[model samples]
Target: MTGRRIVSIWFPRFAMDRWRKAHADTDDGLPVALASEAAHGTVIDAVSEAARKAGAKAGQKVTDARAIYPDLVVEASDPGGDANALMRLCKWARRWSPWTALDGADGLLLDSQGTAHLFGGEAAMLADMNNRLRRLGFASRIAIAPTIGGAWALAHFGDRSGIIIDDDALDGALAPLPIESLRINADTALLLRRLGLKTIGDLIDIPALSLARRFRKTPDATTNPLRRLEQARGRIEEVAEPLVPQTVYRAAQRVAEPVLHVQILAPILADLADDLCKALEDGGRGLRRVRFEAFRVDGHIAALHAETAAPVRTPDHICRLFAERLETLDAGFGFDAFALTAIWHDAMPARQKGLAEDEAEGLALPHLIDRLSVRIGVGKVRRAVAYASHIPERSVVWRPALEEQPGVAAMQAPRRERPIRLFDRPEPITVIYGTPEGPPKRFRWRRKLHDVIKVEGPERIAPEWWRERSSVRLRDYYKIEDEDGRRFWIYRNGLIDDGRGGPPDWFLHGLFA
Candidate 1:
């Protein structure tokens, strides 16, 4: 328990607590029960302490409970609401430890190793946790131990609150506890109890070979009691998923009071931007994308994101990018914490700012692109970037302006003259040539016959060998001018006697102004 300190918290009356919180008008002495619809009909899901004392218990038929105590108060239970509430509590628990998670439906797990000293040692930390939850109207049973399973068992089944189990006392502490405390399923517990394995100590006394033979070793420990026991005794490592992501670059501030508006949040966001920018500059890195989040007092997080057209190191620029979008935050019950993370970055691009007006104007465009993207959407504002393909129609692609156009696009091989307007898909045309494989003398396109005044070429372009099979056809492109001086970009798919098919098909690919 001293090495990897784990904290397990159980909320025995979570559903009833939620119901009470919502219906504050209810008298505390009233016998309240939360009911749910089952195949057998309406059944009690959870009960208040007053109801339990009044002879009403969970899993009882609502009609029977009503007959037993006709004055009992019953409301439908919301399983989804209870689960969401638990997850919210898990995320909020990160205020004490970053490694926190929802443990089942009514518990929370926290990897509180090395954090106890911050809150004035282990006992004080537990005391603080109990006080905080009491203020939020939740009753909690907490325990800290060396392993996750041990902590969980002690918290749920231990004789006292705030139980801290040391490594040497782990066996003694767990031995007397019921086997169900190991988190095995009902069926497994029943099977073990039938075999005279009533307590954790009983399982420990069984031969290891017999235990393995009786229980199937499955990944889910709930079905395999032996595996659950191993995890509890620290024979297996327990991995708990963290509630918050540990981003590479981040800045956060916890406030004394909840902030209600972006006007109040702007300055805080600016400071975070400045700090993040300084760190990025030191590492010779730049912010390509950032996540700005507001943590609400009610446990909901309102998040916004900003992406740049290129690597940016300017704090003011980053702040400006998130300015307009910040107004959209749903600050329910207001936000008590704010965080910014440079989730995506790249090596800063080297640029020499010359005194020339054109160079300054060139830098302005990227800034403009970034702002436009945040205001509208990243996908709305787009630009063209070259693609690595010899096929004329596939040579370029449209992308979001916020994404940097790869340098390879600018350094690609020079291409031949292309038309100003390209067709989305080629249009089939009929060509009349003097020879079977010769240049077209005339062509009929859009139901109009155009006499070829000048035919430029049979520019041979082979299929992309790497992308297509060898059987794929090649193209013979041509620039032709009609008698009326209209220019068209056309190509013949395949070749005569190519052995793959019949005669080649001619099509119009583009148009020239």
Candidate 2:
């Protein structure tokens, strides 16, 4: 396999640029600084280029910066907002490569291994990214290398904005860079500098054991210099988890005239759904969850989501689900664009239409479940499936009806009877006549008294022994019918003083309907 290629885009003034964009209308090329409260009062966290040229710098006291430049614009630094904006940009960067992740608060990493050829070459791709970001009011440094660590170091510290370090020249490209570029902590960097290790080349020839012994106080402490060196040289593998996109199949349409009425959305949604379904069909997939997005002319967005019991490729079915959720969407003034996306999907091969009427009728249940799930949120519609555990409570599991559930036939056969409705936590009841191992003749449950008309079982269940330090006590269950013909499944705690606890307690575990 060919070697992996990684690209790092560093936004040196991300926070300041975001602030500038938020106040673009009022900004008139004045020096700006984002300030945050520090131990010694407010200090500059980030500064614009104009502010940097005017004797203002990060870590400088706000009052000192103001004294240096009287007209400097000061804005409170919002680290969270800056991070969120960078994540949004990471989402937008998916247009260039699907594998893109946030490097830090002000940087992004893209795995463009096999994707660079799509946009001519790595150089062209970097140029395009630079141009687009520049247009978006962000000054970014783009660097491509054989490794993530190398790309990151070059992007932030290299003299060039667009540097492509080839595998053959990896050592030469990184040799002249400062030790700080190795991504060591400030304290470690300071220590390395004090030791006269000013460049990456200075540390490259040092013994790994010597370096570790000098820098690390304990044997357990990580050897940062050696690890960083290995990563930059592409010796150690780096794994990056990219941010998941909301949808795989998406279709959007921009309208010349804004749509104000909900009635007009049906046809638009149908058309978008059809397009999305067609794409799904071509990819041999079907949608399990879908979302409809409306971008308003007033710069607001309204969204509606729908889920299905099974993967569905039918456009009409998808449109119907959106139709049910249309009223929930507030279109604001008017919608200028509409987008339909299949957020969750799965591979679904085409199945033949049932030849027999009964076979075709069997499919209606899933469709009904889908409709109900869409109507009353997915969480509200649930189904019960047999669980593998022998314990009564652990023998059954409840999950969303729209989700795929394990078949009952696949589970171990129940050795004893189980109630139809099982309470999550068994309700404690007062027994009138019962032994620690016997059934109760009369019980008080939920402030209601019930006299036993017929008694059945004394099925004993023991705690699973394989589990480590199992605290579960032994249980003796009984199925009894009351005077009103109501049946219940009740159980007693541990055996009468089995050296576990005090007297055994009774609990109404479930009700049989």
Candidate 3:
């Protein structure tokens, strides 16, 4: 009772014999069924004992199997249906124990230690499981023992039926089983038989040290397979992959009843959120996004996701964000359970609270950005970030407004002024009466003539000498005023000595006022 006990079930020819029958109305005792894609097409993947007796085996070419038994019936394997079937079987097996896994395509392992008595005695439990499977039209062989190895052997190669190994009968039950039943390949089995180590009992009688030395060429030689086999008989530990993850570090509360009304669900959701928030805050981590999965009684799962502007483990704030998505959940057939999980968490950093309203207001900017982004689409709202480039087009970049602002130490807010209306591209405005040597005094711009009343000195900005200037022009910008009381910022392109072979031109760049 102190040692681990496990059960392994093998469907000798699950996919093949799941539905195939030897006769139309009766069971075919002599006819063995196999499931394969190759009847007259490809090779077989599974074969029954009757088919094996008729010289048919797995991986035998369809033609070869037909040569042995022409009347053999084969069907293509449906892997998807097979998987769904296995999952359904796993669910049914859960009635036996909470721990069970689909061991590959055709087998299952159940850990039934403390849970066995719930179904009666060990013999009765084993019989009950096997009978339930049989009633479900599955020809299954189930084995229960103190070790996985023993159970596997009993299920696959004992008396053409299954065996149940309790502690009292461990040695006696495993005495007659073959060493090959330990799951050695065909080649290894033949090699062991050649070495006069055929049955498990035969291999057990040999001294471990001698067997390792005598069979130096075999795979089992290194560890003395017999000793390992014996050690596994009653003292081995059973590791079961639970159908659901163990609820240890994680906590969950499933609603047994479907809650269609939001009023009823709101409090329950809020409670769970509060619990998670407390757990997260205590751990010094903030919640980034929380998922609420609603499992409906109709077997469909609907999920709602809420992402925060900042890492926050506040239950009230989290619940408010999720409220937006509650309308989308149909609650069809009613929601049977509600599950919540948090992702993208970060440790909440220690910081001083802002005493002034404006200081707190700046901190809330990121949250305002998140709300704006949700309303106008994430792409439309963002902070205007200034860059170090002198080129106006490359002077700024847009970023997601919801992202946390860079630490104040890393960002020095630009001291220079920014234009209220910046055009996508600077428009070219023609100006007359301007020469390359000086700024435009009186110019005709936009088909209107303006007389210069006040003028400023030209600020010459020359293009780099080695850089290509095919699309760019060297300019001397000047602030000017017209007699009508309008101010204009104008620039004259191409100095007299400029290398580019073009006449100097005047263009009005921007209006000063």
lDDT of each: 0.84, 0.82, 0.67
User: What's the best-to-worst order under TM-score?
Assistant: 1, 2, 3
Q: Rank the candidates by lDDT, best first.
A: 1, 2, 3
Off by over 4 Å in 1: 217-219, 245-513
The lDDT of model 1 is 0.84
State the lDDT of candidate 3 residue by residue for 307-393, as single tens digits: 666777656666766665677788877887777678567667544456543222234665565556655666787776654334444
State which candidate has the highest lDDT: 1
How do the residues 1-513 of candidate 2 rate in per-residue lDDT, one tens digit apiece?
117788999998889888888998865568888899998899999988888999999999999989989999898999999888999999999888888999978899998988999999989999999999999999899999999889999998999999998899988999999988988777778888898998999987564445644655633213377667767777665666688743379999999988888888999999998899889988889888888999999988899877787788888888888787787777768999999988888777766556643222245677788888878888888897765456777666778997655222223676676788988889999998765457888989999999998888888888866541465678888899999999999988887768878888899999997
Q: In TM-score terms, which candidate is top?
A: 1
Displacement of the residue 322 alpha carbon in candidate 2, Å: 49
| Number of backbone-clashing residue pairs for each candidate, in the order shown | 1, 0, 2
Q: TM-score per candidate, in order? A: 0.48, 0.47, 0.43
Q: Which wins on lDDT, candidate 1 or candidate 2?
A: 1
